[model samples]
Target: MTNKVLNALANNSALLKWIVFLLAAFGFVWSMQLFIAGNAYYSVKNSIEVWQLSPDKASTQKVNSALDKIDNALNYFPNNALFYQIQGQLFEWKAITEANTKNTDSPTTDLTNKVFNLQEAAKSYEKSLKLRPNWSGSWIGLASVKRQQGELDDEFYSYLESANRAGPQDAILHKFIVDFGLQVFSARSFHYVKIKERLKHHLNLGIENPLSRDFVLKTIQKHNANEAVCRWLRDASYPVKKRIPNCITYN
Candidate 1:
């Protein structure tokens, strides 16, 4: 019985060695594949970053170059929100450049091109928001492009409201809403009520957040006489109003 066992072990030793060798080879191949894939992903991502940080204007050649980089990266990470956001930003930049183009040779043609660029930018931002609905930055980007195109009506204000909701703590978004309200609506317009509400909300937040406090104060200092600020001051607690010299003047 012992001799039979020894014979069986000897017969299967070569087969066991082959099995181990195949497993090691398979592991090496799999590891190499992962390493190659990771390196490609990072290289494309870095190229996208380089194009984004570049100071070059959004000329046709530069836009194409940046889009190409983003496309390559998307091939590897198709659902990446940042890539889509960057693409939207590039389109927005292109729109601004087009709007600023002074084609003395063909003014009508330049206007047509500018409109087309803004449309493209809006489309890009819509696509990005579809992928990432809660992205306040994309909303702001879209709102900015639309505002530049003179499309800031009721629907435009809705976008700003959505941006505020999506990024309540974003100081920049707060500032943008304040600026947009002041620029687009007359202080006496009912629409300015939205701006007042936004200010009050931020002021309440300012009790605990230093950034919010500073931003609120800065906005008040800049637009103290605006109806929204005066109304907010009037409606605020007496103590709060007393502390603000501008509010006293409004009274």
Candidate 2:
């Protein structure tokens, strides 16, 4: 049998060579995929583990240590948007903790540190967004950090606008922007009105599902917004035009 196999391969040398080439190509492609997936997994694992350590901002040393670990991970996975996002979140969390601590037992020096942390958080979120422009969560995180940092600049609003544009169909994303706008912008301001209208457009585009309408109304009312604006429900021409009693009035 071995002699017969050798004789066949010797006769079909071209076929044997083609078979070897195919096998090598398949192995190379499989190895490349595994390498990419392995790197992604390692980056994500490091990110999760850093947060798992439960760094406390009140203990500056602990927060700093966790940050150092994250930085080290970034050295290997610089493009891992998730890690950058987590770094942004950790910095923001530290800022909140620092603010709360300042209210009770913090020293004057802590105020400077709190500001620095917020600034760093903003930069981190921006970096994450640049790496993953279509990530709605990263946009929202940037918006939140900017808001916390008292940034009412064009950049702050752009982050939110980009988020809504990136996920117009995402009901939760619309609600978040609306809720945040209501809290920060005056009801009569152009920014607030634009955000409300954009959210209304999203709902309308969603076929005006009754559930989304109800959710939006509830969220608006939660922010002490006038129930009358629920008028957008009927105005948007949703299929379910049934007026909500307390929420929607004929007047």
Candidate 3:
């Protein structure tokens, strides 16, 4: 009876050990699955936040850093359209910085560099558009670069027109169009146009027309009157009607 009791006790101990081992195995598997799921959620959440934050901020450094993080995430999920779009936007931000820093004394060289950067930006935006054709912002970005480059005026206009058609309700798109029109006027008058024509075309009477008025107003607001261009701009602003042409009136 003592030997039998001892044998039964040994059997119970072995069964308990097997149960404990199985439980431990299950726990390990469950823990691993939870960890993996948590990591995936964190990664996706971070990516979405970065996408949302990039376009809202105007700082170049911040935009670039966000894009770098997004690119790193893409190694794991290579097909994220948002990542591509944000990357394109970052490139565009850089291009805008380059374009706006032009030097009048070295207009040719400065413009050349600006054009190169803008073209690169256009390529990146085109890539984003390829991934997500419905993104109106990408089309606007592409058009802005084309405008900066000055090599494809018609194509640039077409892109802007398409962007408008795609989403006329987007106030940001309209603002971009307005700002771009102003920039083009500033650059053209500052570098390309003769003083007389610049005044007549950009600042003189009937200039308040929709197309030219915004540009004239923006130029006067941003530049000083000491320069010849500024002198004309100042003179142009005197008569309100003279500064803006009737045809260019915004409804």
Number of the predicted model whose TM-score against the real structure is largest: 1
TM-scores vs. true structure, each candidate: 0.55, 0.54, 0.45
In the order shown, the candidates' Cα RMSDs to the true structure are: 7.9, 8.0, 13.1
Candidate with best lDDT:
2
| Cα lDDT of model 1 by residue, 132-165, tens digit | 8888767877887777787767777788778878
Give the per-residue lDDT of model 3 (tens digit) for 165-193.
Answer: 76654433544544444444566644223
- The lDDT per prediction is 0.63, 0.64, 0.55
Worst 10 contiguous positions by lDDT, candidate 1: 48-57
TM-score of predicted model 1? 0.55
Tens-place lDDT per residue, model 2, 1-251, is: 69999888787998889899999999997687656645654654454344333333135455566567677667666887867877776787677666656754546678788888888887887798789888776787788777787776788778877887777666445545555655644446656665666655653543354424555555555666554445666664424334334543469
Give the Å error, residue 150, model 3. 2.6
Candidate 1 CA-lDDT value = 0.63
Ranking by lDDT: 2, 1, 3
Candidate 2 vs candidate 3, TM-score winner: 2
**What is candidate 1's CA lDDT for residue 108?**
90
